[model samples]
Target: MKRTTIHISAALALLLGLAACTQDEAGFLPEGAEGTPIVFTATGLNPAATAAAGTRAPVDGNWEGVSLVGVLIGGTVKAYDVTPTTADNTSATLTSTDPHYWTNHDDITVTAWWPYTEGETTPPAVVVRADQSSPTDFEGSDFISAENQPVSYGNPTLRFTHRTARVTVVLTDYTEGMASVKLTGLSTENGNPAEIAPYDKGGDTYTALVAPQSVATGTAFITCAFTNGKVFVYKMKEATDWQAGEEYTYTVSLAAAKDPGYTVSEDGKTYEVYNAEGLKNIAELVNEEWKLGINITLTADIDLKGIDWTPIGKDNNKAYTGTFDGGGKTITGLTVTGSNKYAGLFGRIGSGGTVKNVVLEGVQITSDNSSGYASGVAGNSWGTIENCSVSGSVSGSFSVGGVVGYQFGGSITGCSSSASVKGTQRAGGVAGTTNSGATLTACYATGDVTVENDGTSYAWAGGIVGTNGGNSILACYAAGNVSGKGSGTIYVGGVVGENYATVTACYWSGLPDNDNGGATKVDGTNVTWQTAVAAMNAALSGKGWQYELKDGNSLPALKKEQ
Candidate 1:
């Protein structure tokens, strides 16, 4: 209920002119006079702006979906059909199903309407379906008619107007989650309240057609149901009678959603968390070991608003051991300032734990004092992390990284980070250090990695891992600048400061050369930001991974659904 701006507008409907006629020896022309083919050229079937299914009109300034009618002066009539001339359907030409002709300058009454129904001798009745979920149904509700125009030899011209009223709802200022809109309180012709389903035009727009009807005041009409468990109602304050050929539009601005309380997923294994409170509650439950292995899913984007946050698995002994599926949602404004041993959104991910499809935005985590492991995601990862990305700033004393502070025997796949990181010992764009047979595949980082030259015996900075200790690194790249701060020699590399085991098809765009304590420039491929997407995808092919280049990103990122 944060947003209060709701605007409505009603506008007059535009009318189009059309002419139609039919063919028969009796209705053709004057008796015994050789008749010429009556010329039928269609015009003016343009759709309203951004109207869902608006472009489906049969005419490109010509005719489509039109049924032509020619009424002889003597009360005889016939209907004909038309076809478009261009393959692109930009224009139309008449193809009379029942050909007709005029002779001796004979005059007759003509009628036309769309869409046409075959086997009907007369103009069809308006067919307005209650449900408009299908776009064609909504378009079919648009009954336009041009009735009773005198047609003589040359060309027939008639005017058409919509017989049903149109209503459109557009949601504005939408920041997160999906919206489902419904229209209620409109009475059907039978005088009972009718619930109308509109056709979604994508981009938060929905449109529907309603037959002319009277609506009473104080009636709840528009309802917007959001995925975050927020429902808004718009009721009419004044009685308004809907009329034919008129259009109504309602624009509703949305706001951040509040916590939706506790909700469980259909499988019952995964409980849904909607807002900041729910997220904090989930962390608490896991930390207490009561729900340590229970799955959790995010149902909406959460904004912490710069409040201090404690990592989920702050206690290493009770580390998170369950799955955390973000459901392609974003977690924003995660701020933490500490010098604890483990620091990040999650301090530790225990064995058998999995986190995927999670996006962290504008996070600020710093552990400036003492030696601590820190990253945007987890400080010590001993489990699987996949299809997740982080963006912001992260710094620590010893192990520091944009993604994970330490990969102590686990796997990270299809993940990326663009958070600047700093540390006195091991620091990198992705993880600070990895050992014990850890494997990384199809991942990249674009955040600058700075290893402070505090004269530490083994300070190193790399675009990917700070010190790869005999681990498997495959199909990964880094594109951030790696530099040594302060004094003393801190080894830096474009890809990894040191590599002991397997490193294949890996690339770097940050360091001038891949030369380091272990693998050198010859061990890795160098690609620019412009050419990295194809290279990463090519390298990751057959490896069950693909890279995509996003706007304003210098490195290829793992694909995540919105």
Candidate 2:
């Protein structure tokens, strides 16, 4: 019986060995063999070459979930799914359940595609629906791995490239009364039935994935519709070969398109001619259908002292929720005199709003209402305000500030204010009140803050922020005198009148005259007037604050005059 058992075991081993050899003969080694595992990597190609010569260009986006088809030297093809292991899809591992494993002596050619279906001769043509998201497209590439490779375990690598081109259209110099822009005649170059869809990337940017084809001369056209019910058509004059792994960017300026050389189509259906002009000023923008998410770019510096200025969104019912790009232009000599609750260049700025690269100089904002908000920039802001500077005076009965009256949530970074602030309740050189979701960083204020109330009312006055409620103030300083004179409770601090949250690496200069007034938190360091200059320069320099001494006696001003 023992002899019979040995004979059966030997026969079973032989059968298994034959099965392994059968798999090896089919162009794949048996599993668990002493060989390296094949790895597949995929990366997107940049749209254009970098300006630096001989430098490696950057990839556009993260690519993943690519289907790889490996054809062996003997014409035996196998399919494997390769998924990205990292977020960027720079590297991926090939996964398969086939019994055949790659060997050192094997030579294979591989083709890769995204959104590929199993058992398909060619990848399906990418069908982009009208509602498809921006950047919707498919990519394919082919590569060949030569013979006589190393036989180390887990060492073979394969890379895949993109075989399609992408195009991006940006509309610049946008004037008022322009509603929407559309690009047409983007079909197959051969006049095939293939349809291509361009996706909107929001705010005058459109992107489309195009197959490698040659566009017909003078066939492509773009249309811009204005609010005045006029349409303009721009015919393409130049053409190029749309190659794979390439990106093309087209910037269309509305100001340039308004030239008489371009054909203007007045009829909505057919192409006709119509003369168009851009809106004149901000007052026209305010009178138009200005709403949230609108993009406003200042072309030139606006002087509001001479014009009859009306603040945009002057009430809580209507708040500015758009983008205001100052283009490094200054709005000087802006004066606001009214008893309105909200008074500023912009009355209220809601969430999702942004104001940047703006400077307000010699502005005077005053509010006579007992409980109101007043500022040089905005009365209330819950959005982003960056790289902005204000030098003016703001006076109000309640919340008053230089940049913003009330900052609820969002960020105020790389900003400064040298405006004198006076309020009956809360007054701050930069911001009156900051809530929990607000963050003030890398900012400074050099204006005096004063809070005066005759009755038993609370007066909060600070050089940077009047009332800080569970917010974050980092690497900020104030070099201004803070005074609060009231019969009731008064809080005055050189940096912050009251503190509830964290303040890190913050400093304050000048003495607080009120004995009862001091930085609520001991973390805020105070430096005297004599050593304040050097101390501030040293402290700010350590935190990467760009500053320089223009005059010997003056404090270190921000490099941008903050």
Candidate 3:
């Protein structure tokens, strides 16, 4: 390990700015006389050092204006704001706002540290931050001090020593603005993690100020996140005790992948999944092993190319009750085909379950049984589904939708689906049949919903939902055509085939050639795709959401998409 230290010492000292000045002129009274104000002058170091953005320290042999330092004499503490006095910055003048005077001839031991805390007599706390990405933030995390040093009133020599250990990670294949590294595997407890960011120094130089602590043996501390999406973790082969005023450097050069695709937290309740197998593991844990309360998060976009899919939950009795946050990542090429009922990415989401911030692209879900249900996200939902989307196609016999086949006794908010749907009984763009006070808020669907008859009786199809079923649909829209063919008493609508719920500020585009399945039809005011985004945004205000177009697409998108 290489070493580098940040040490500051005074080079030259001059007392009272003039050698011929008397004690009265310098405000220094006789020994044990009236109290006198203490004057100060701080000298500079020999070598040059670079200061961060807001620390006001010296950078390249020049001080960045007034540098603040705290001085403590006996039980009193005062601030000393120092400024440069020489062209080369080897000399400086230190002044205090709240001046502390010399009361007696006895010399009081002085202690000092860079940067002072206002309205506090005790020394500042030393809890380091997790983010040191910016220079100002990095500099602010450093606490330098000169403890129990002697001071001369005429020419005080104050020097600062580094109070923390500095660590530098040099990536052999580092790229500008394309790579990142973090110090991991630190001791964390009570829900607080020590996530240390490497302070970038242009090109390949990255340094981090770490609090002095012991690095346990074989602990992987530095995680090198490469630009090609490869991660390499460097472990300490031997335990090293880090002390203040010392620096450690690690040069990394690895040619192989080191990550296992799944990083579980210390508490074992959360998992950051990075691949398709890891995602499948979550489903197996939730359904097979009954680990229903674990939380799963996606760290990267996964591609399900050739792997056959199994829904997270098998049925309503064995529904997924865990929380899954996608971290705004996508899962592409999801294919679910079976004759089983309650089928989708998730078979059923039970009460208290939540799934959000996920996008399913190019999905194909097909149900063979005549009474089965199929969709993109879930077949049936009794929980919360928020800020999710789907595309491609979905087909089934009984109930089918682009996002969910059946929604009951749960809430769906800020979700969208653009997949084309085909079904026999009830088909919809967003949901097939929503009942039991199911709520839909700020949701939209833009798929062509069709109801076909093979051996089924009358069918119903809608743009947003097939059957409202006395639920609540608020500030939602559907921009696709809803139609029916080869069915007895076929019913269709722009919003819903049957409306028995509270529909507030809902809109739809061109549907229901005849009647809106006993419901009112939509007009051009809220149906135009150009202005529909803003209008829906205005309608969903104070609902904890808004709308915007994502990636130059003309369709309205939720905030999670951004």
Ranking by lDDT: 3, 1, 2
* Candidate 3 local lDDT, 25-120, one digit each (tens): 655565444466666655433244323221223222344433787778878788888777777776566677676777655556777776567665
Off by over 4 Å in 2: 1-288, 513-545, 550-552, 560-562
Comparing 1 with 2 on lDDT, the higher-scoring candidate is 1
After superposing candidate 3, which stretches have Cα over 4 Å from the reference? 1-260, 513-535, 548-553, 560-562
For every candidate in turn, the CA RMSD to the true structure comes to: 23.6, 25.1, 22.8
* TM-score of model 2 (CA atoms): 0.47
Between candidates 1 and 2, name the one with more favorable TM-score.
Answer: 1
Find the candidate with the highest TM-score and give its number.
3
lDDT score, candidate 1, position 43: 44
Pairs of colliding residues, candidate 3: none
Q: Which residue runs does candidate 1 get wrong by more than 4 Å?
A: 1-260, 265-269, 512-535, 548-557, 560-562
Tens digits of per-residue lDDT for model 2, 188-304: 443422443356677877665555566666855466778867676666777776555456777777864433312312642111112111212332344344544455666567666
TM-score of each: 0.51, 0.47, 0.52
Pairs of colliding residues, candidate 1: 18-158, 21-69, 21-70, 23-99, 23-100, 60-90
Ranking of all candidate structures by their TM-score, best first: 3, 1, 2
